[model samples]
Target: MLHRLVEPAHKQQHQFILDRLVGVWLTLGEFMGDGDYGDVIADRRVGVRVEISEGQDRYVCPACEKPMILASHRIQNRTKERFYFKHLFDDGSCSGVAGLGEKAIAALRFGQTKESVEHQRFKFRLLESLELDPSFTNTMAERRWVDEDGVKWRQPDVQAHCNGQRIAFEAQLSTTFLHVIVERMVFYRRNGGRLLWLFRDLDVSHFRLAEEDIFYSNNRNAFRVTEKTVELSRAGKHFVLECVWHVPTLTRGGVSDKLAHGIVRFDQLTFDVSRGGVPRTYFYDYEGARLQAEHRLAERAQTERDQELRQAFENFYLPFLNGELNSDQVETEWPELLSRFRSRGLGLPAWPDNPKGPFHYLLAAYSARAGVPIGTDHEDLVKLAHYLVDKRKHTLWIFRLMLEAYDQKEVMRRYDTTGRWLSKVKQYRDAFRRGDSHYMPNRGFDDLLCFLFPEISDKLVQAPGTFLGSART
Candidate 1:
């Protein structure tokens, strides 16, 4: 069950997140309010406020002013310190264990909306992950530094040190933060620190208004996964995320996302800052090389599919659809779902020479690889689709696969089995849908992406950091 996998990671990540939230929450205390723990509204009749501070702690109630007796106590001393839970209330009216949780969240004023809370928890996880990494040490939160104006201002969020180099990380939950990217980057450049940006998801309105342009790229891949449903989802759960590396820089537009989120992390990262924190040109080259290697390994693992099964996804599902999805319904009810795909390189040419159809096949193939089901309406499916399509737009997925395999094997075999050159194709429409997870595209269709690298490079140059999650300022 999803719970089994997430519960453990949830517990661990929850603790880690709470620790990081301690800093963020505490830093926001004054802005939120000065009381110990309280949540009330303009209509005081509606909300709850539990004030605990000074003399009020040993006792209970602002009314009692009485020295309260300890009703019970359980204390176990350990190396980490001790666990102590006691009840002493002059008023004897408190929510108890459940109240404690409610109060904590109320103090933060976290919204109950799923995305909002998830983002909050995610920000906590991001900070925590950054803290524990050996690559990032010496965490600094809430410090005053003088800017050029000689005026003192508080920092954006957390700054950390690794290998004697300090890096600044800002979790942007509002659109206003977008305008500050260049300023933040300037800070990084001036302070000689690497910048880690956390931008709000643009598609969602929950986040505040933000700028559109400061990032490297917004192109992500598109795909779908059928029969895979989320198991456990909660305020306290976490997921492990992985960085999709090696898509080629010019193609990718230079971007990275915090993995080990959405799912709780299984283990610590090896913490390789050497390859990280380098100039964009450096990182781009590394990803390009790795992607080349991955394509070869993947094609070899392909399984044989019968023609019958191929037809199931071909006419209607060459991209793996059993039939055409209802466009009328999707556009009416989930218009953004369509926009999400179109936004992520769906319209881009797979390569320079041949533009339209190859790009479509590239999206289709990427969807197959990610285990994602094809459709534009469902939220889950849309995200998966966005991821793959974005990848094709940036990597020229089809072409790169062939280009890399050729570079590795010195001969293109499989489809032809004995040919030194990869099968040549007059057009991408030459590709065939062999059914579920199977594709026998036209010759050279496999190299559709790579053939257009020169053009992709030009685009990258014109719009540096324009794809991936680059706008997450």
Candidate 2:
């Protein structure tokens, strides 16, 4: 009796399940018996899957074309699992509705319809446009195409051949599942065909998620067909579409995108087949422009950061140089300034004694590089250079090296117009050559000098052995 009951139950199984979204049907028994069917049911891959809730009307019965609900039940002591589809409203309208359960009202929803009037009109418009274009040939509407494996097929709204390439145009007027879009793209790509998703209209000011799904996935390009485009195609005697895309722009804040659109002939668009994981179509190179904008934004940001850092350093150092802040006070505030530099991946050398700190050395170097006074009341870099050589003999060699290394030969020549500074420099050079400790190189500030002026770092007399080196190490 038990064997007879099992045989009868298996004989009453539903024949097939239909996915209305992608317009694909699958044999129920064959899909259920396949080992990989679990992945399909889980919606983990890009293929046909019954993704309907208990009351939702996504999948339907193949025989009656009525909404179907998935039913699951356990059998035996081992908790064996089995799943099947039954009519949501079983009113004796179909044979597959028997022994399922009580019926419920099917919810009317958008995207549940097979095709809308707008979608059909858009399809016909594309068909007409393709027929008008001399570059396209063998154009057909609602043509079915089989993949290489012959296991899957897609009936594109309009199909055509362009320059020895198969082109399938899908008119999208409503929201489509991402998997549906990806599956169509994969199918067309595998069959050596290109799929172009067309929109009836697109509002750049506001973008629906579905529109973005198509726009962003196609290299930030979205094409639309309307009366204007169709008229243009008729006038130009070629296929035309209003192509909308994002134009990368560099702004004060950062890189931004500006919406741009224009009516373009089909030949103006690029048919890119080398790219993978995206629709092989675009009107402009948005990705390339975005990368260039990002690079320029980075350069602008770095320039701004350098300006802010220079201003802050001058603000802090000027006051101390004029004796408004003592060594202890400068030391107290040094760490905070150092923290800011550290945040920008720059390391400052340790604070030296007040009279011999980096303040004067940096001021002289900056003034010389600018060809004008930066911190002090000196009229020109010549005066600053003279002052450093006369009063700060300990910094003479490094300052002289900076002047020469930084390409300030004119300033040096102007400083020695009367030969006074030059004579003094020669005396200091002679003393240094005679191993005079008074004119020895300041090795302690090598790291700080390098950090402040990286151009002359290679010309420093000694190898860096300070905080900059230690931090990098």
Candidate 3:
């Protein structure tokens, strides 16, 4: 019972040191239901936490299967912050407490240093193309540029000055982390320089995630430098690039863009730095084209809706006019048509006690404007015109204006051999002027007439005296 326990104390001290070592090694964690372990360092570099706040995404230690949380640290006087995963509860049951041995760290460093031959060749070719252009000056390969604050710096693959403007070009050959790309863009923008990301080729059918990120962000445009482009540059004695862009087109589904590419000179491209100091360089105006395409699609949709409404009205009104439906049936169905018209911002008066009188009057006015019978039993436009002037005297003002607005006087003259229709119109005009006639204007029926025949809307707003003065002399 009094035996000394010296071994336990020594083992506890060793475990404490191992815990610290494992803490440094735990940079990755697995999100619940996700097979891959998300890299916290990359997330921190981009200032976006994949797991976000606590409990947002259930993350666990990749090796120990214990609950984990994202942890961050910033050393004094350093601009960059470090991020890693830490165990929620540190019970010393996990074998990862021993840390990742030295051999594994060495392999990681070796793999990062081994750059692909293709990437190196692309860098050299881009440098060569810049040198061939006389417009470019002070062009260098792998130059380190310091920001204005002197707290940040970036070493672009190729840098140059053209037209007193600084431009940096980077060749994307393989998978590059989003953080690295974003950081470079921010640094260049703040330093008053333009950054252009170049690629070797693009497979639009099988676009990589990285390619999509670049393509969509830069006005749906991507640039490439291929062997053919370099040869053209050499022959033309200037800088050239193969530009790939999306041309917006209206499709049956919606507005879509098709892929288009061409060889363009450096000077031929638009270099705009107006939008929030972010540089936009492209051969085509993708934004403008897309906006125009969207506007066209909206107009087409509106036209189609107007035609559909016109057809529905014709179907209901023609049957009632042809004696296929009785007045009771029309009264019951008139409310439904009113509801449809209201949906399109067209308001009509409620169903009256005698709907046929007003309905027939409106049908006569529409038939006159259209130069054909629409919902009336009249055999021709002249007959409908005579009925409107003789029976619907209260609506005679708008009916005359509609005739002049739609150029229906010729049809009236062609049929009225005795000048009866013209004489009736003049007699009504003289009586209305003398204020001794039943030429009252019904505002409700006028609105209904305008809705049925929109061509006379402008003329309906004019004063009766003003409209008649401008009428055919």
- Which candidate leads the pack in TM-score? 3
What does candidate 2's lDDT look like per residue over 97-172, in tens digits? 3354322111121233234445566777788888778989999887789889888899888899999989898866
Model 3, 1-473: lDDT tens per residue? 22211111112211211111112122232211122123333443222234434343233443454555445455444443333545556676764434665455433322321244555677777888888888999998877999999887888878999999999987655445555666777888889888888875866655556667677767777888878888998999889998889999999989987999789888877756535554566778888898899999998998788778867776777676656888788888888888988988876557632554466556655565677777667877777767766787666676676677778767777887787766776777776566544775655566556666667767665545455642221
Lowest-scoring 10 consecutive residues by lDDT in candidate 3? 5-14
Q: Estimate each model's TM-score.
A: 0.26, 0.55, 0.61
> What lDDT would each prediction earn against the true structure?
0.33, 0.66, 0.64
True-structure lDDT of candidate 2: 0.66
Among the numbered candidates, top lDDT falls to: 2
RMSD of 2: 15.0
Error of 3 at 225 (Å): 2.0
After superposition, the stretches of candidate 1 with alpha carbons farther than 4 Å from their true spots are 1-123, 145-154, 200-473
Q: Per lDDT, what order, best first?
A: 2, 3, 1
Report the C-alpha lDDT of model 1 over 1-473, residue by residue, as the tens digit: 11111011111101111112112221111222322211312211122112233433322221222222211121233112111112343244532323345345433322221124445554565555554454556777544434555663336456667668665555544333332455555555555555544443423212222323323321221111111111211222322222222243222323334311122231322212334342221123344444654564443333122233233223333322433446563334334422432443333232212443454544444333333334334233233333433333332233334233224222222222433122222111122211211223333333323222223333323221223211110
Q: Candidate 1: lDDT of 454? A: 25
lDDT measured at residue 51 in model 1 versus the true structure, 0 to 100: 22
Off by over 4 Å in 3: 1-117, 132-134, 231-238, 267-281, 285-288, 321-323, 352-361, 369-380, 387-414, 420-473
